[model samples]
Target: MRRGGRERSMGFFEHLDEMRGTLIKSAIVFAIFAALIGYFMKEFNEVLLWPLHYVQAEKPTLVLELGTTTVMEGFNVVIQMCFLGGFILAAPFILFFVGQFVAPALTDHELRMVLPLVFMAGLLFLIGASFSFFLLVPSTIRVSIEINELLGYTLRWTPGSYYSLLTWLVLGVGAAFEFPLLIVLLVYMGVITTAFLRKYRRHAIVVIFIIAAVVTPTPDPVTQTLFAAPLYILFELAVFAGARVEKKRNERLRAP
Candidate 1:
């Protein structure tokens, strides 16, 4: 009995230590990537501008202008973009570390389900990011630029502002895309049922559009459509995925 009690005490400390170590390591890795990205800010900035380069190249005065009143203003903006770029690049690693640290206590079946969930979440995020970069980004920038021309306003975009808009939209949409995966996983774990999802379907549609409007970077209707349409489709996909999970759960319950 004493041995069992002592082991339990030690196990608690061990878990705490493990969690601390994981957190520290994750932070360190993020910092390292941030520094590296900072060092290569110009190169990454070019990557961010590639879409703009292609779409707006016809306009000679299309430049992202930064107001530099401080000695280090340029450096500060570059460093900021680099940090965001690094975070984007390191997202998978961060997610993996989180999974490693938190998921071991789950059952084997849970682990199996969760691995695929992680993979699907990552894939969906990538798709969302791509959508933002290729379609939404170009479309919004084009519209904004054209609107400036139509309103007879000279628009000078700053690099910091532009990249902030870009990164936020990309990451935000990517995170949003994981909603379906979350719903599916919840159903698979038997935490939520398909019936509940179906019952709340209309309410979810209203909420989904609200979320889409908030999450999308541009307030324009076209960009909102680009963001919300995919989200609605993903919600439908989640319903289907939830049904599969429900089917599996019912099968297990019916097993001898």
Candidate 2:
């Protein structure tokens, strides 16, 4: 084991014990959050159904309702809600616990770097999830409704399918928002440079649009642009940050 810039010998069994404790703590936190979400399942259901509500309000002529084909569907949806919501709510605490477990093994400089990146990752995820919930999901749903109506199809989504879509959009976009962090890490490790990012900027933009189109679930160019715009901005920001890291690296290389 290591702590405060000093190392202490520890046996394999001791490490296993520490890991078991961390896992137990993490599981406890997750269970608590899951129970809390289950207790407020009605409110949580309303939040998940907000996009449908908004669309109905906007297009008063259209009727939209979520259904369940099987008796167990409702129960499954509840479980899905509780698990996903619990994970989201407990994510920060879980990360903190993992950080605590690993902190003693990391040098001070490495710990400092990792801590900020973890925090930034959490913040970016929240931003992306909020953006998806408020903007992307609704826009995609609206466009989907419009397209289906154009094809003479009425909108009748099952609870399982609807919630599955919701989870995919929210979590997918949130994960995508971590792209900049990956880029920064690559730059730090000298795997890619800022110049390469700039050289391929246009290509990256095209790829971003493609990804946005695939992820947004609608063919509407406007919605796709909305999804891609922030991602493009993040890519640029990554390039800028990578440039700084490159400069610092170069300076260090020349120092001695």
Q: Please state every model's RMSD to the true fold in angstroms.
A: 3.9, 1.5
Q: Which residue ranges in model 2 land beyond 4 Å of their true spot?
A: 1-7
- Per the 3 Å backbone cut-off, how many clashing residue pairs does candidate 2 have? 0
- Determine which window of 10 residues in candidate 2 has minimal summed lDDT: 1-10
* lDDT tens per residue, model 1, 1-256: 1221322234778889988988887787888888887777678668888767866776777764445555876776777776776677777888888888767666667677878988898899999999888887887788788888899887767666677778787888888998998888788778988889889989988888898789775678888877888898999899998998899889999999
State every prediction's TM-score relative to the real structure: 0.83, 0.95
Global lDDT scores for all candidate models: 0.79, 0.90
Candidate 1 lDDT at 229 equals: 89
* C-alpha positional error of residue 235 in candidate 2 after TM-score superposition, expressed in Å: 0.3
Candidate 2 TM-score, C-alpha based: 0.95
Which numbered prediction scores highest in lDDT against the true structure? Answer: 2
Q: Residue-wise lDDT of candidate 2 within 152-218, one digit each (tens)? A: 9977789998888899899989998999999999999999989999999999999899889778877
